[model samples]
Target: MSALAEKADSPLKKKPPSWSDIWLKNTKPLKHVVFTMPLQSLSPKDPKSQTLIPTFANIDRTLLLSDELLLQILPKLPHLQRNPNSLVCKRWLNLQGRLIRSLKILDWDFLESGRLFTRFPNLTHVDLLNGCLLSPRDSGILLTHRLVSMQMGSGFCSNRKFLEEDLLPVEVVDKGLQALANGCPNLRRLVVINASELGLLTVAEECLTLQELELHKCNDNVLRGIAACENLQIVKLVANVDGLYSSSVTDIGLTILAQGCKRLVRLELSGCEGSFDGIKAIGQCCLMLEELTICDHKMDDGWLAGLSYCENLKTLKLLSCKRIDRSPGRDEYLGFCPALERLHLQKCQLRSKKSVRALFRVCEAVREIVIQDCWGLDNDMFRFASVCRRVKLLSLEGCSLLTTEGLEAVILSWQDLENLIVVSCKNINESGISPALATLFSILKELRWRPDVKSLLASSLVGTGMGKKGGRFFKRT
Candidate 1:
């Protein structure tokens, strides 16, 4: 053996550390720099010209990414976590506050103060749907300046607004309206549940751009307030109340609305005790009115006579109503209005055959007929469709009195009939499901029970004041 081989084989020989061992020890920077070779390759030669390595901060981060990038990200995070992210740094907090434009707090109880307005100064929309029934002190805290669309829902007791005020020491008053007027001048759309007439009137004065409004349990004074909104194109008045007799919006209120709201194109009255005179006045006064929906409202044919004068009228929807037109002589004047296009009857009762015939005769020009949950209508009433040949769509739901045989005979004859929807019609299912009816339903398009699809779609569009034409109606799933 050579002298070099004898030295390698010696037990006392000092061995050099492996590359992995030296690299793993972070503290041994000098050894790593010398051994890894690559670490020192890019090391600055001039100590004076050297720069520190990049980091989350201290580097030219503003050059690499702008504040605008951060502003876009912070607000997009979930609301619960947004606060945590903002707490990370002052820059993050500033971006979060500046970037938020709209806020929708489902719980009103959690909405503590005007701090929300300060936090998001540029907010255009605010929806406080729940917790409208807050105490007087808490209710007073709801003040916004920049809201364009607002929907505040609350519940109240008492049939009359005045009674409600008397029962509850605190009510939506001029004070609240003053806040909205002072802050939300750009307000265009509002849906407030259980607000007083005076408060609504105050809104009309402040929100000149107001185009659409929905008020639950409105009264004559409320209608007067609505009249003040000269730009109003759509209005829905709901008179139903929880544990209350009814809202005090009768023919008197309707008359007020008809006289003042000339720009109205669509109007809906629910649970209103309005008669023919009030509705007739609407047709006579509101020249721009197009669509009308009356739900659970008191009426007879007097309104039908008046509807003949609505030159631009297109659609009429009767829901959960009874005796839509009983004044036989006057409604005869409503025959064959070419512009009237669609008729929808839902959960209604046509007490007399004469009344049924009268209603259908006026809608002879209607292209679509939607019938649902209507009683006192028999196979004989289905024959009305024969005369109304223009009806391309016939939708029937829960019409227990209507038989399939009677419907098949009338609908099949109409060449323009494009669609027929039959759902939960008890009498129709008694006999074997007619092959002809089955084939008709199978071939026809768009058939189903639409519970709230129309309203939901409309809310997403009209409630937000986002679309001009608003939502198209669809069957509910």
Candidate 2:
């Protein structure tokens, strides 16, 4: 029991029992536990806490979602599912209606019954062409004072008889228009067939935001109603399509339209007959007019001269026209459109050399010229386009009579030309290309030369290694 004996005994003494060992010795033994009652109940309730639990069948996830979250999700669904989604609930129906911006109404009652507004309050575009028809699905004869006497004995269908009673009363049509105008104050575009002036006047007065309007079977008087559309920029007036209907728009209607819609930017006249006076009014008054499309027109002999008055006109399209002008008058008197940039002619009959030359003279300042499917456009007729010295883009298609030499002569004169597209021209072939024309093609910024199917197939097979000789079927020439 000396000091050395005490030190040795201290080293032998064990350290205090560790905490983990002490806890394991003091903890209770583990036992398996099982739930006695069912995890779910049909009539689950906590009476003591005064709370009611919901069942899976009674719970609705969509109802729990906020309107803001639903709005974000509903639009991502495909359009085909919209109709079914709308039928899910009243809230969904209202939300789906808010997304519709355009409607083509075939039923007049849908617009007149004040339902369209309640259902879709944000509509911006509407088309009422079919609604106004007497028998939309059937062909009905128009009842008027002048009637064509058909031979009953001839080869006419006996069952196909159209009577005047099939047409709707004028008053009934006006009521629908009034309802539409009152309900859709934000309408921006409208299309109607055989609409009266009174009906259109109501629409123009209410829908001041209207920017585009199309009127089929339009007459001189209908334009009077259209004049009220102050914001109107684009208009397509179809007087007649074929011999089926006899409606006319003359100088008087043109003058009214021009004076009222001074902000007009684009105008299309289909089967309309006008003189110099009408064209002059439009060119002078509609200072903002940029595009003009004339289709199957019946203008006077010297109506071409009036285009010069359109100082801001940029694009001119001639479609399915029988002639440019019977007589465009002297070249000195026919001034050019100062700001004209593009001239497009499609499916036109340019048979007369005199009229074609006059048209080329007027559009001499054009930068782009596109001629497609034009008949009687030979080398002599195509030469007239050489006057467009500033042309930068030229697209010629379906010009059967235009030979490679004719195109070369015209394009060589265009020193500023950068883009050229020639397709479906039978007379233009790779064999006709000269050294000078080949050099021009090389210097061009972009060139698409597929005058026939053989060239197009060869070009497509060029890089794919589909053809012989290293897939270089189309030579440089």
Candidate 3:
């Protein structure tokens, strides 16, 4: 064999390191450089001359990428980490501003000076609560503005006069509203406190696309401005939420809202006092209305009869209500809502057997029923629900007074039931599950059963301004 061939066959000889191995072992860090096109023209006459030199510029790598590319990359990072990138340069700051669609105003000056618009030009949703709820710097408290406000009012027990003192002056909020109107013409949603009629009018004129609005301290006079919003669809009127504000939005405001905003799809009345006439007007005027919510309502007796007017209402939610109706009148006169598909009762007082039965009668056609954390809902009281024959879904939570027999009896009457959820019912133990109920459960398409789940003790604290508000969770306008 040749000498080279003999050496190749030698097992004792050490092999040389591969190029990948050498590259992997190198610990020196790499420096990234962005190359740009030449800006200066070359000297043709002295092309080879040493006197004329070529210069390479060091530039920001981010500038080379288009705004479209940067936007795609920035969103992949968490918002907390992504914030630092905006401080890098003016380009990044502007790009980051474009990404923000919602903002909560704490400083009224921020909105009044036009800085809000210049900074967040694309904002579609804005909350002016913090601005209106601002407290004097001299107050000297460690708690946040909202927490301080809540404590001052003593939770939901605060009277109207106390809340009035906490709110900002009307004119100050009006200036900020005007600024918001001029800048955010595409604004779709807004949450504001104590805005005057003129301020709201300005917003209505400018923000023609406004759809959802949550108004605090709303009154009959202020609703006149809102009526001008032709595209307004969803509205939450807070006339006198216990610890929040004091002014009342009565039947007059409801009538004005119903007549002017005929395109409304969803409406919420909180701490409002209205009778049958106002509700009848709403049902007659807002033909597109599909959902209606009444929280801590102060409507007079016999108002429950007015629900029959809402022919298109598909969902009726009663939250933290003390009573359905003091006097719903004769069962024949208390007509039912024909299109209602879902009836939701949470943290409500369902003690009066007559009112409870009337409520069940009004929602007789409901396909789904949810009863959660309601007081005075015993087996006898729940028997009233048997009138709802079309119920296909039933969920019961935090109903400590409800026994297994009560639920089983009501569900057995609902032959069309497909889904059942029973959770956190202290009285509904495993031993209470009857043979018939087990058979019915086996046939259900979906069932979530946890009868031993300790009833939520805090459910009773709802509407007391103790827990997080639902509006903050919704990201979409």
lDDT against true structure, model 1: 0.65
Candidate 2 colliding pairs: none
Range of the 10 consecutive residues with the lowest summed lDDT in candidate 2:
145-154
Per-residue lDDT of 278 in model 3: 85
lDDT of 2 by residue, 1-477 (tens): 698788767857757789888766766442111222343443347655433454555667799998878888998999899889999889999988887889988677888888998899889998876566555434353323221211122323444443222334667876887888899999999887667899999999898899999887778998999999989999999886553355799989999999999999999998898988999999999999999999989888898999999999999999999999988999998999989999999999999998999999999999999999999999999999999999999999999999988998899999998888887888987667776777676666667666764553343333432333332222322
Candidate 1's error at 467, in angstroms?
A: 38
* Candidate number that wins on lDDT, 1 or 2: 2
Q: In candidate 3, what are the lDDT values of residues 210-238, reduced to their tens digit? A: 99999988899999999998799999988
For each candidate, what TM-score against the reference? Answer: 0.66, 0.79, 0.79
lDDT of 1 at 189: 69
User: Which ranges in model 1 have alpha carbons more than 4 Å from their true place?
Assistant: 1-51, 54-113, 119-130, 134-171, 429-477
TM-score result, candidate 3: 0.79
Q: Output the lDDT of residue 21, model 1.
A: 77
TM-score computed on alpha carbons, candidate 2: 0.79
Question: What is the C-alpha lDDT profile of model 1 across 9-44, one tens digit per residue?
Answer: 888796878987776776578766677897577677
